[model samples]
Structure formats: structure tokens, C-alpha cells
Target: MGGGLPSDARTMVVYFDGNYVDANDAKVSVFDHGLLYGDGIFEGIRIYGGNVFRLDEHLARLELSARALMLAIPQSRAELAAAVCETCRRNNLQDGYIRLVVTRGVGDLGLAPWSCANPTTFIIASKISLYPQEFYDNGLSIVTVPTRRIAPDALPPTIKSLNYLNNILAKIEAKQAGALEAIMLNAQGHIAECTADNVFIVHQGEIITPASSSGALKGITRGTIFDVARDIGVPIREADLTRYDVWCSDECFLTGTGAEVIPVVKLDGRVIGSGKPGPITARVLAGFRQRVLVEGTRI
Candidate 1:
């Protein structure tokens, strides 16, 4: 589905399949494998102060995910990058989130993707979000969900594909428990990540995050935060982290394109660092924002 114009000046446009469509008119088939079976990959990108932050890194991850699924992108990397910028320009989006997805196109009800010859590519430039400002300022409380991350050997965590039922289920559990976010444990009962964002902790003046091998996404935001921590003289490390470690952390937070850097003051009924945003977390957030505004590349 596609359209050329928007109902209102603020509605803007989106690129769907091979055509430019009004934001409201962009739609995929009911039988598209991406929707039916989560047979696709996607990326979440952020725009800050009119500039797309770490666009190349997001695209690189997108391509890697596509390749991992053997799903060919309809455009080259350079072409796709330009198209993302063009979509943003057409929409007049400056400070918003971009969701780019590639689906296995329409196919039969069967699970086989071979019948779907062409993959569908769509880019929507729109504002997106996560935790409210109050949550960031006052800090959020999270609970450890019973759900465990998918074993890496089974689904390969590097594939940022659309199979998020696991994450959604955990989110539902968190909501039912009256918590802000859910902390997922690995198969072995160690902390993996939140439903979406990567998890990190600060202890003894050092920042530590769980290794991707522990079933977390190789997060671009996490990588940038690491660099920012180093620049600010906050030593960072990546290693296996357990629920006990999180319980005893001096400070805790989660990182993602949408989540940004949010402080978690409590986990599973335990208070983290006097139950407030710690000094190290605040400083790291400041560094991240500074880098995004000054050093980030424009798209």
C-alpha cells in the first residue's frame, strides 16, 4: 500500500516497498511473512538536534542482520543510507526515531520463505520513545521476569529480526507486576538484558555490562556509552553478570536507541545505590548527549 500526500502538513511521508507513501497509507500485506512469522530484520535509529546519530553503525548492523537471515536488501548500503536520509528530509523529521524494516514479502500461509521471492523494504521517519522524562529524572524500578532470553545457539542474538514475542511477553509480565521494565535472565539464570535495552551496572567507580555472548544484543548504544565512559575516565568492562551482581550494583541503567540512557533505581524489590540515579550514570549520560550533539554524523 502506498500514497503520495499527507492528510495534514505534519503527517509527512514514508517509504513503503518501492514507493513513497503518506504516513497513514503505508501498509503491508496481511500474509507478509514478516508479520506472519516474524521473518524479517529491523533497526532503530535516532535523530538528535537535526542530525542522525550513528547512522552508519545502525545500517551496518541492519546489513549484518539481513545477511544473517539470508534476506537480501533491495538497495545497496550506500543507496539505503541515502534513502533513509531522504525519508527523513521528506518527513521534516529532526529529533525523532527512525524504524527501518525489511520483510520477506507476501507469501503463502506456510512457513517456507522460498515462495516469497521479493523482500519488502519500508522506512518510516517518526518520533518514538521509551520511558517518560520523569522516569529518567526520578529513576525507574524494574523486576526480574521469569522469562529467559532465547538461547544464542538457537536463534543467534546478533540477528535484530522481528521475532520479539519473547521480549513482548516479558514486557507484559513486567506490566502486570507494576514495574517499569523487565529484566530477562539467561537460560542459566544470569541477567541477560531488559526486554529491549542492554543492561549495565556501575560498581567501584567502574562501568560493567554483560557480554553479548551471554545472550544480549550487540548494542550500538552500549558501545558508544562504553567509549563515552572511557573518555570521561570511567573505566568500563564487559563480562558475565548475574542477578546477584545486579542486586548489589552501585548504580544500574539500560541503553538503546529509544531508551537512550535511563537510570534504574531498583531491581526485583532491591534498591540500587540509595534508590536514585547515581553520579556515574548521570555523568555518562551527559557525555553521551554531548557526543551525539557535537561529534555525531549528520544524515
Candidate 2:
């Protein structure tokens, strides 16, 4: 739901299938199974100040996710990495988000991924933001959704598959509940994550998050926050969390490539610390944003 680079920007470069093309010229077949059955895997990457943040980590996760689903990405890891950078350079992108997708190519209307002869690759680099500028400044209010994240045994949270019906259900629930975001629980009644971002909470003086084993995507932004935690000497742990823990938390936040680190000041009508973004969360968010702009392998 975000727009691409400005018109005056250089020709947007996109790597599709096996060739580089103008972003506007990139297209895929309607018969593609990924469009019909959501058979694909994708990663959302961020670039800042002319540098791509966490390029290696995002690529690694992309490969891991693809492997989990037994989908073959036609290009090697190094090739895909260069493709992403080239796409960014083609767009003259100094700061933006990248969506890298590998889909099951056009095939007969079938449910199986194996029916496809060749995997279709599409890369689109653009700018994105989940919330408006005011939300980050004023903090967010969220609601608990009836839709639970799929248990790991059923869909395995490790695979960032394209099937996102579970997430979409939670988003619908959040809209019905009159909140900006939805808090999804796992089948076991433990806090999992939001519709699109990983969750974290501050208790007493330590940072705690629902473990990846508890059915959350191992988010790149989540990993970066962990590094910041360690660098700042804040104790962090992966544990099982419940609605009660979130209700009593001193601070709460959500992380993703698009959402970044956004503080939640209220949950299900309960106010978080001072009903505002907590000191620790603010510091970590600022630190993480700063890192994105100042460092990374330049394109």
C-alpha cells in the first residue's frame, strides 16, 4: 500500500525471472501458482542513507525460508544479493524498502508447488511505512485478536512462506476491535506476534520476547534489536509470554522492516508505562534507526 520512488528518480531497475528490466515493465503470468495459491516466499529489506541494512542477514533468512518450503530459487545467494543491490542502484534509492519474491511459475491450476516447471523471481525496491509519522511519534494502541497464529507444527513458523491468511485474519479482527494493530496469540494461548511484526515487552528492568519457537517469525529487525540490547547491556531473553504479561509490561514494541520499532502505549484498553513510549524503547528505536543510516555495505 505504499508508493514507488518519485518520477524524477532514475529508471527503476527490477530483476524478474532471470533478467533485469524496468520496474514498470516487470510483469508475471496470471497463471502463476503463487498468485492463485500463495505459493511463494519473500523478504522485506530496508535501505538507508545509500546503504542496505543487514543485506547478508536478510538474504540468509530468505534462503532458509525458501529451503524450508522446498522451493528452489533459481539464482545463487551471491547472485540474488547483487540483484537486490542493482535494483536499488537502478532506482537511485538512497533510502527505501525492497520486496524480494520467488514464486512458483505459471502452471496448471494445481495446489502443489512441484507442478511448476520454473520458479519466477521478482524484485521490487520501493519506499514503505506501515504507520503514519504521527503513530510513531504518539505511540500506538492495539487490541487482542481472536485469530491465533498457526501453530509451528502445522505451518512451522521458521518458514516465512507466502501464505498469510493467518495474518490477514488477525488484521480483520483488529479492525473489528477498533485498534490500529492486532495482537495474535498462538494455539497454546501464548503471545506470538502481531499481524506483521514481532513483539517485545519490558518487565521490571529486562527485555523479554516470545521465543521463535513460540510461533513468531525470526524477524531481521528483531535480531537487530537484540544486538542493540547486547550493545547497551540490556538483559534480553526469549520466553513464553501471555496477555497478562503484556498487560503488566512497563513497555511494549513491535518490529519489522516496514514498521521498524514502534512502541505500543496501550493494549486492550490497559495503559503501558505512563501511557507513553518507555525510555528503554525510545533509546533502542533511536539507536536502531541511526545504525540503518550510517552503516552497511554501500551499493
Candidate 3:
């Protein structure tokens, strides 16, 4: 199939398997279980100021995800880190997004995973497009979708697996509802997270987010926000949250590798506190931006 690229687009160099190849030349077998059965894991990392933000944390998550699937990465953690930096160097990226993926290698059509021998690994580094500047200033309006997050007993959210149809379905609902994102609840009807980000709210004077037990991914950005909150003298905690809590909270925001930290002014058509980015949210976001420039391994 054609890559459907614009003729003027730059040709990207992608790390395929163990070698770097042109984007158009990078290919994986159709029989790969990761393609057919979503038997794999991935991580989305950020490069800020020529440094990879939270590189070690992201890699550790990737390794944990792979172990959960009984998949062995082809390279050690140090080697993988080098590969990521080399890809950024080749792309001449001072700031960008990095996608590291590991798939169960080629296998027969059978559901048996043991049939696959080697795992496939690849990395892609490219520019990131964040939410519109207006959204950052005014905040986002979101809705709660009917699609709920998968139960941890069935498929743990902490795995960061390639199978994201649950999130995609919720995203579709958000789009249909004229919103940029959707809020997903867990099996017990407690707030889990957004389609692809972690949810946070400010109540009274504390910053609150759903616990990992609520089926939310252990987001790297979410962890960073905890530190940011502490640095800014804001108390933070993790607990089970409900829609009512969000509606009544003083502030709301979502955090992720791509979205960074974005405020939510309205949910389900109800205006959030003051109908604007709250003072606490603004302080935390500013602190996060400053921390990004100085933390993480230098590329």
C-alpha cells in the first residue's frame, strides 16, 4: 500500500529492526502478530531542548510492557536508548516526538504466540503538533463517552500495548459529540482517564487524579505533574473520581506525552470553574515547561 505522502514531504529515516531505513522502505511482515493480533507494546517520548525528556522512565515503561506480554526486546535498555538518540540525530531533531515500538515478530495465522521467534523493534522521530494555542489559553471542552475503559483484569491499562481500539472508539464518540477528547470510566463507573491522556482535577485546594487501579495508564507526564505540583506548593493525590467530582471541581486538566498539560474549561456542556484555565493549572503548566528544558538525558 502507498504511504500516502505529500510529494514535498521530507523523507524520514526510520529505525527498522536493527538498521535505519528510509520511511518508505521500512516494512514489517503482514504475518507479524503485532499487526494481526496487536501482540506488542509501544512508548511515545518527547525531546525538548535537544534532550529526551524522561527517557529512562519511558524506556522502563516500555520494558515493563514488553515483559507483561512475554516479549523480549532485541536490544538492551542502553542500546535502545542509543538507537533513539541516533534516530533523532539523523533527523536533526532538536525537539520532536519519538515512537518506540516492539512487535511480536512474523508468525503463522494461528493464534499461538509461541510460533513467533524474534521480536521486531523500530523507532520513529518526528515533529509534534500540540493542541491549538487558543485551547491552551481558553481551555478545552470535552464530553464523557459511552465506551468505557477495559477492566484491568482483562487487559491491564498499565501495559501500554499496541491494542488501543478501546481508546479509538472513545475518540470516535468524542468527535461525534463535537469534542476533542472523551472521558472513559472504569468497570465500576469511576473516572479512569481520557482517550489518550490522564485526567486531573483540583478540588478544594488539592490536585486529584484517578488512581492507577482505576484503569488509567501510569503516564510519565502524570508523574511529572505530581512533582510539578509539589514544586509549586500544590498538594496532589490519587483517588477514585466521579463525574460529579469533576463537575464540582475548581479546575480540570489532562496530561500526556503529546498533549503535555492542557486545561478543561467545560465538560458535558457544563462550564468548569470560572470557565477558564484556573490559576493552579496555569502555575503547574508553566512549571512543567521549565522542568522539561532542564531534566532528562541529553541527546
lDDT of 2 by residue, 208-229 (tens): 9999889989998999999889
User: Candidate 3, TM-score vs. the true structure?
Assistant: 0.98
**Top candidate when judged by TM-score against the true structure:** 3
Candidate 2: where are CA atoms >4 Å away? 1-11
Candidate 2 all-Cα RMSD: 2.7
lDDT of 1 at 26: 82
Instruction: Kindly list the per-residue Cα lDDT of model 3 for residues 190-270, writing each as its tens digit.
Output: 999999999999999899999889999999999999999999999999999999999989999999999999999999998
lDDT of candidate 2?
0.88
lDDT of 3: 0.93
| Residue 1 of model 2, lDDT score | 88
Per-residue lDDT tens digits for candidate 1, residues 99-148, read 89999999999999998988999998887758889999989999999888
TM-score of 1: 0.95
